[model samples]
Target: MKKLTSRIDKEKLLLAVAAPLLALVAALVVTALVILATGKNPFPAFNDMLSYGSASDSQVYILNKATTYYLAGIAVAIGFRMNLFNIGVDGQYRLAAFLAAVVGGALSLPGIVQIPVIILVAMLVGAVWSAIAGILKVTRGVSEVISTIMLNAIATAIIAYLLQPERLGQLDEAGTLVSTKPLPESSWFFTLDMGPAGQLWGFIVVAVVVGVAYWFTLGRTRFGFDLRAVGQSESAAAASGANVKKMIVTSMIISGAVAGLVGMPTLLNDSHQFDNSFPLGLGFTGIAIALLGRNHPVGVALAALLWGYLERTTGHFEVIGYDKEILGVIQGVIVLCVVIAYELVRRYGLKRQQQRVGAELAAQAAKTDTEVTA
Candidate 1:
């Protein structure tokens, strides 16, 4: 029994690894074909990307980018685990960052006091915004997908209205752009001076902490078990005495709270304000990363790094006379491949399990018949 169990575990691990590998290979092939159709040698571009992306400066950039991506991925994964499609992550993070920046800019306090306050405000705002969708889903039978998408539009409009010179925003002396007031120098997050390699954002440490917390909460706690049970089958969970409606709302709030952190790396370490230049569409990217990672913490981290790598390397293509649009093609292909590969692997695993169970039952029956004959 022990040997059989060990074998099964090993097989499962192999299957898990195989899915990503298969997806990557398929993506590469498709990308190569697309490049060929464009009358370019894809191998040279691939080699150049590998070389450029491995440079020390590039590594720093990738880490900073991955920090944001990791946070976004975690926020989306939280929703994915609960069988929830939280398309509002973009709005949630943007609103959180905007409000947090406004509050931080208005306050002058010790770093220890002000930073936490800003973060808390962001989380609270994000939770409230997402909870609206959750409450509607549970009470009014509205689809979260529809509500979250609509909320995104509303959030955009609100930001546009509030980000005026007469409102919470400020215009620079040049008058070309409007943004929230810049955070004080004292409130600036720490960084590691890597000399020519550039500065590494301290927010990477925060991302690591978030990942650890996510793993512990989801894998080791009773609440995690209930959440997973409800995700699998809400009716079954309710039959088992779980509060289905409450779980849905709580999960959304938690997901949004994390989503609030997605902009911190940029706001604190680089931009220091919420502005027109703040990244958009990151919530959509997070969905891809979450799917690629299968919603596991370590896997999500790796997927985030991969995303950063692709973005970092692909920009160099334009400088080398290659079309920058290749990035979109590659990313889209990879996501599609990942989806297909995982589904195939899942079906294969299910078939293997069924076979194993049938064989075990047959052997048990044969042994019983032999014993009766004896």
Candidate 2:
């Protein structure tokens, strides 16, 4: 029994890893085909990407980019684990960042106090925004997908309205752009100077912490089991004494809280203010990353890094005469491949388990027959 259990565990692990690897290989093949169709040698482009991506400066940049993506992926994964598709992560993080920036800018407190305050404010805003969808879903029989989409538009409008000179925004000395008041130098997040490689964001450490917490919460706690149970079957979960409605709301809130952190690496470490230049559409990217990673914490981190590497390398592809659309092609193909690959692996594993069970049962029946004959 112990040996059988160990074998099953190892097989499960292999299948889990195999899905992503298969997807990656499929994506690469498709990308190369596309590039060949474009009348260019695909090998050189791949070689260029690898060389550029491995450079020291590029490594620093990728790490910084991955930090933000890691947070975004985690935020989206939380919702995914509960079978929730939170399309509003983009808006939630944006609004949270803007508010946090406003608060950070207005405060003159020391770094220890001000930084935590800003982070907490971001989390609160994101949670409240996401909760709107959850509340509507439970109380009014609304779909979270639709509600969150609408909330995203509303959040965008609210930010546009508030970020004006007379409101929460201020004109920069350059007179070319309007933005939130800049956070004081005291409020700046710490960084590691990598000398020629550039400065690395300290927020990477925070992202690591968040990943650990996510793993712990979802794998080792009762709430995690309830959440997963609800995701699999709401009726069954309720029959098992779980409060379905409360779990929905709580999960959304927690997901949004993590989404809130998605913007901190940029706001606290780089931009130091909210402005029109603040990145948009990252919430959508989070969806792709979460899916690619199978919603696992460590998997999400690896997916985030892969995303960062692609973005960094593909942007340079434009400079080298490759069409910018290649990036889209690669990303789209990868997502499609991941979905298909995971489904195939899942079915294969299920069939293998069934076969094993059948064999074991047949062996037991044969043993019983022999004993009876004796």
Predict model 2's lDDT versus the native.
0.94
Model 1 misplaced regions, further than 4 Å: none
Best candidate, lDDT = 2
Question: Worst lDDT window (10 residues) for model 1?
Answer: 1-10
Q: Estimate, for each residue in 1-374, the C-alpha lDDT of model 1 and write its tens digit.
A: 56667877888999999999999999999999999999999999999989999999999999999999999999999999999999999999999999999999999999998888888888898999999999999999999999999999999999999999999999998999999999998888899999999999999999999999999999999899889999999999999998999999999999999999998889989999999999999888999999989999999999999999999999878889789999999999999999999999989988997788788779889999999999
lDDT of 2 by residue, 301-369 (tens): 999999999999999788899999999999999999999999999999999988887887898899999
Candidate 2, residue 357: how far the Cα is off, in Å: 1.2
Error of 2 at 336 (Å): 0.6
True lDDT of residue 225, candidate 1? 89
